[model samples]
Target: MIPEFWGNGIAANPDNYLDEDEFDSSYEGLLRLSERIGDAKPKGVPEHVIHTLPTKPYLMSKARSPDERCTICLSEYEHNDWLRDLPCAHDFHKECIDSWFKNSDKCPICRRSILENKEL
Candidate 1:
C-alpha cells in the first residue's frame, strides 16, 4: 500500500478513526491540509465561527503571563503579542492559533471543541 503525505506531517486515512461525528472533519484530516494549500476555510469551521472567538493583544502581568508558549509555533510569546482565548479558557498567540483554527477548531492542548462555550 502506498502512503500519502499531505504536506506538513499530515496524512489521509480510510480507517475512519476521526470521522465527522468523532472529530468533525469532512474528509478526515485532508480537509485541514487543503486549508493550508490555499487558506480556504474548512467546511465545519466557518469564518463566522472563527470571528466569534475572543481575541486580544497579550498583556503580560504577574498573574497572567505568556508562561505557555504556543503549541503550534513552539516559540515563546513576548509582551504585546496578540492572543486568542479559546472557549476552553486556554489561549495561544493569535497568529499561531489563528492559522491553526483555520485548519481545525479543537484546542491544541485539551482537544476541546472551540465552540463548546458561547460565553467566551
Candidate 2:
C-alpha cells in the first residue's frame, strides 16, 4: 500500500472517522454523569492551594510594559488591581484567576500545573 497520509498514524488506519453516532447524546448529560461519578476529568487542586496563591496590588511601575492585560478578563490591568501570581510568573486579576481555579488547576497561558509545591 502506498503512503498517503503524512502524520500521526491517523492515516494508517482506514477507519479514521469518529464514532459520533455512539456519542450522539448531549454533552451536558455526560458532563453531569461525570460530575456525579467523579471520573471524567482529573480533580482540581485543593481550596487551600488556591487560597495560598500569592497576590499583590498591580503596580504599573513593576510591570515590564503598560500593555499587560489579564488573559482571562482581556482587559489592561489598572493600577492597584489585585492580582494573583502563578508559579509560572503569569498574573491575572484576583477575582478572575480565583474564579478560574474553581474549574482548573493549570495556568491559563502556560498550562503549568498550579499544584507544584502544595501537599495533598
Candidate 3:
C-alpha cells in the first residue's frame, strides 16, 4: 500500500523529522543564543524622566573650590552657568549632564542612579 502525502508533500509516515539527539542539540543552541542576547547592556532612562531633574546657576561661594569643575566636561564652572542637580546631590553643567543622561541615568561623579530611591 502507498502512503498518502500530508498536503504540503511530506509522506504521512516519512522520517525527515529530527531524531532525539538532533532535537536536543537544536534546543541547546536556542538556549545559548538567548543567553547571549540577554547579556547585552540595557539602554538609558526615558527622556521625560531626565527632564524632570532640576537646574540652578553656579555660585562660587557655595561651590567646593574656586576651580570647581564639572566632572563630565572637565571645565571650571563659571558664575551663572546652569547646573543640573541629581538626587545624589552631585551636580553638573546643564548641557553636560543632559548629554550624559542620553546614554546613562547615573550621576557622573558618584555613579548614583537617579532612578533609585524615588518613584516616577
On lDDT, the stronger of 2 and 3 is 2
Per residue, candidate 2 scores C-alpha lDDT tens digits across 1-120 of 445564547676757765777553588968876677787666676778888889999877753674588999899888899999998999999999888888889999999998977786
Give the clash total for candidate 3: 0
Off by over 4 Å in 3: 1-41, 62-67, 118-120
Model 3 score (lDDT): 0.79
Q: Residue-wise lDDT of candidate 3 within 1-120, one digit each (tens)?
A: 444556545655447776777654577787987686783666566778878888899876763684479898999998799998888888889999888887887887788888886665
Best by lDDT: 2
TM values, all candidates: 0.54, 0.66, 0.59
TM-score ranking from best to worst? 2, 3, 1
Q: lDDT-based ranking, best first?
A: 2, 3, 1
Q: Write the per-residue lDDT of candidate 1 for residues 55-83, one digit (tens) a residue.
A: 88766676654455777888776678888
Q: Return whichever of 1 and 2 wins on lDDT.
A: 2
* Each model's total of backbone clashes: 0, 0, 0
Off by over 4 Å in 1: 1-44, 62-66, 117-120
* TM-score computed on alpha carbons, candidate 1: 0.54
